[model samples]
Target: MQKIVPNIWFDGTAAEAAEHYARVLPDTSGRVLMRYPEEGLPDFQKALAGQPLTAEIVVGESAEDGGCRIVLINAGPEFAPNESISFMLNFDPSRDPDAAATLEAVWAGLGDGGEVLAELDEYPFSPRYGWIRDRYGVTWQLILTHPDGEPRPFVIPSLLFCGAAQNRAKAAIAAYTSLFDDSGVGMIVDYSTATGAVRADSVMFGDFRLAGQWFTAVDSPEPRDFSFTCGVSLQVNCADQAEIDRCWEALSAVPEAEQCGWCADEFGLSWQIVPEEMGSLMASPEAYGAMLAMKKIVIADFPK
Candidate 1:
């Protein structure tokens, strides 16, 4: 019942991704939170006539530390990677001493043909850290908080961006840390003259808080196979059109911006600028009708 359940947008695999998440996470289950059940056989047939069915699921652990729940929703259209959103993982190095190795296996399993943005390495920011995308084209950052046998948890919370110009991770962190109270960067390491930019003597790695949650970021200058995509988009609930307008303008400045509440920042991530009352409005039995209403929403007329 937590208000903020991280929401993941799928090209068309919300149910599928939720299942995988349920299996991979610590103590969690992915169950269908909602589905468009056939209203009337005729209407259902009409709805199914040429449209695809959609489903949403809540996935996470039920334990004390496992309050993480993500809602995965299927997309009505095909999805692509752009810079409007990205998924982040908060890894606990203490839970499993071999946590780093185990994470590599997860990447290897999921990232068959996906590019390796960064080979696993011991970062100054953390003991171990790296980034990779699965064959499914989803981006993931694996951070090992402690490698020297310490107590920790592995968390992979997704993030949303309004719009970033080139690569928004750094900028997003900067903007995010700016907006939230009691949130800031934990550690930042850049390529020193000694290390050089090619790799760098040290790069940023550490906790950054946004909306009171530990968020982290690093710069990836290249457009790798694993860029941001709708498979995981952050959903921002704005208070009013004025707020929506501010968010939309800032987040849609990138080249990969798209229709239907989707946009990529300069960094190739996607995000959704939704109204605060959207959840409540769309939770009713008429949600599908609302989705139908939303399907016609133009980026310019979104809110403001």
Candidate 2:
């Protein structure tokens, strides 16, 4: 299983979104998990009964596994996807003969009910590139990869620290790298000119490794109406309770935001410090009930 996975929250469209991606993207698949009402928990059960609560999806292929696994949840409309976090899709012609065609197909599929943030065109960064927000409000940055540059994963999560968090990208990257084993900071390019609210010399673009996964981050100077929310989060699956506690101690900043193993870091990015055995324990209604009542997960509550 992936140690760290991206979790996407949607307003009851998680299953539909997952199905769309499974059909549109090559080498991808999705499975939905429903939440049925349980006895003795009237309010909680009533709120989630018969809901297609979660969707697990795999996209692209990885050397360690088939692809990246993401969790999607129908968690209501309290939060919505924004540019604060987006996925970057890299299509390398050298790796796939049908790269260009695949890119066009994906662009059209995603653009069906989406709005283009950056039109596809040649830029100094790549020959073909575009940024778009899909119907579900999830943003994606698609680029025809340069054959000469270092190879990267098929899909990578990108963090844009905008608004009040502007210029704090480096700090967040540092914190994450330090928290995860086998992690390190990579190339970082600073902004050359002040753009809107962002200052020059702040991170323009950078890459970092956390738990052996590469993720990009940038300090966007552009003003935005939204900041980081629970709409998107990074779930870190720990080997044991010790690992979970350590991560929770290091990453959690807003005490009030901590709930059911979920927390918000100092940079406002959300994270879930979950135990590796959570999947198996969650199968039991009693364990699930215990999970709902706790702020942080307790392994002892679930029987081995």
Candidate 3:
């Protein structure tokens, strides 16, 4: 029942990726809604088009679809996953009379500096959108007209991981499920082919529920760029500083850790241990001075 769900990536081009993607989709708003982990927000990286671990972008759905709902993550290179994960969009069939046409237009825009996989085609499953690794080597599948058109704007039901790192998929799935409550592996199909005949779908692909969102992961032989950093960060709304520190300490425990709340976990995935009320606090005049004082902060900075 998540209205606007995005299975994002943190390739070096988070801002560029968001800007590029925003151009193709209908909404087309000014770039940048929010950037996080004050110290982690890089100056040279942004100029170099480096990946971002924390970002919020507005794509698809202009005024009709209801504001910029989709978000991207540039959480840094440590957290970059191959095409095994992607974002899926569910267009409103009843309202979008020319869904195919609109979808194709979007494809063309995003495809400007990117590659196309299946082109814009009506598949047996649904009117689908497919694109292989973009210029940044990120894969995406944009689907239109949900099977039931049930006002489900978007869903990350599962993620598809491809490339030489199939085994890594299992490790990532297991690690993530352990961190969040109500998380467990759903369906898994592993290595079922004609006696070791490695078809594209030979590896394992399954579903998992993390936090409250549903996602899928798979392993394929596709090569991926190690360009993903901490640009696209998962925005967790914490109840208090206790919750923030609990998740932060648990996730960011690797050497690749950076300031401004970005860190690589033991699993190589990047995360931001940001406060839930940080956004509201920063928007205030008083907090702005404190924000400028330090790149990263704890609860004491914004005491109750």
Candidate 4:
């Protein structure tokens, strides 16, 4: 299982967004998991009666076999996705001869009713690259992978440290590497050494491995009005309550933001420190009730 899964909050379009990705991307599929109670919902969730409570979207293969997995959160419109967190889709020409064509097709599909942040064109970094935000407000960076570079997963979550979080990507990576097992920092390119517009000490591109999963981070070269939000959170599936406690103690920074296992980090990024058996525990309405009354998840409180 992927130790860390990206959780995306959607006002009411998680299922729709997942279906759209399945259609536009290759080897992708989405399936609804648990749903809200038929009745007796909290005031904030009354609007989501029979809709999908959680949808598991798999991109580029299967999550069970170690592929890219994302959890779609069905919640209210209190939050919306922004460019603070964008997904990187890598199409390696060496792997697929039609990688370029496939990139074009996927770009066209994602462009439907969406806005392009960066045009698809050849750049110093990659021959084909572009950045776009889908109609649902989720952003994606598509690039035709360099043939000679080390292979990376088909999907990798990319973080943009902007606003007050500038020049903090390197520190964040160091902190995360300290927490997760089998983790290490990958290639890093600082602004002083990177091409294009230059600045001294800021990270232009950096990647890291957290519990064996890959993620990329970059310090925004320009100022932005947005920072991380609960809409895009990283969910760490713990093996037991001990693991959850350890992670919660380390990553939870914003006390007021703690709710049902969701918490904000020092960098304003949100995270969900949940148990591996979350699905089974949530099957019981009593467990669900117990959860809402708590902040950090407690396995003992959840009755089977």
- Supply every candidate's count of residue pairs whose N, Cα or C atoms clash at under 3 angstroms: 25, 0, 38, 0
Among the numbered candidates, top TM-score falls to: 4
lDDT of 3 at 108: 67
Q: Give the Cα RMSD of candidate 2.
A: 1.7
What is the C-alpha lDDT profile of model 4 across 54-99, one tens digit per residue? Answer: 8877898843355698988887788988999999999988878999
Candidate 4 clashes between residue pairs 3 or more apart in a chain or in different chains: none
lDDT against the true structure, per candidate, is 0.53, 0.85, 0.55, 0.89
The sequence of per-residue lDDT tens digits that candidate 2 reaches over residues 141-207 is: 9999988888778888999998767789988888889888889988999887887867787898899
| Candidate 1 C-alpha error for residue 82, in Å | 7.7
- Give lDDT: candidate 2, residue 137: 94
Candidate 2, position 245, lDDT:
88
lDDT of 3 by residue, 85-171 (tens): 455555556757777777677666656677776666767657575654566555666677764643443435334443333346677
Give stretches of model 1 more than 4 Å off.
1-7, 36-66, 81-132, 147-153, 157-169, 193-207, 221-231, 238-268, 275-279, 283-304
Query: Which is the leading candidate under lDDT?
Result: 4
Best to worst by lDDT, what's the order? 4, 2, 3, 1
Question: Candidate 4 regions off by >4 Å?
Answer: 62-65, 193-199
Please give the lDDT score at residue 105 for candidate 4.
Answer: 98
Misplaced by over 4 Å in model 2 are 34-36, 40-47, 62-65
Provide the lowest-lDDT 10-residue window in model 1: 295-304
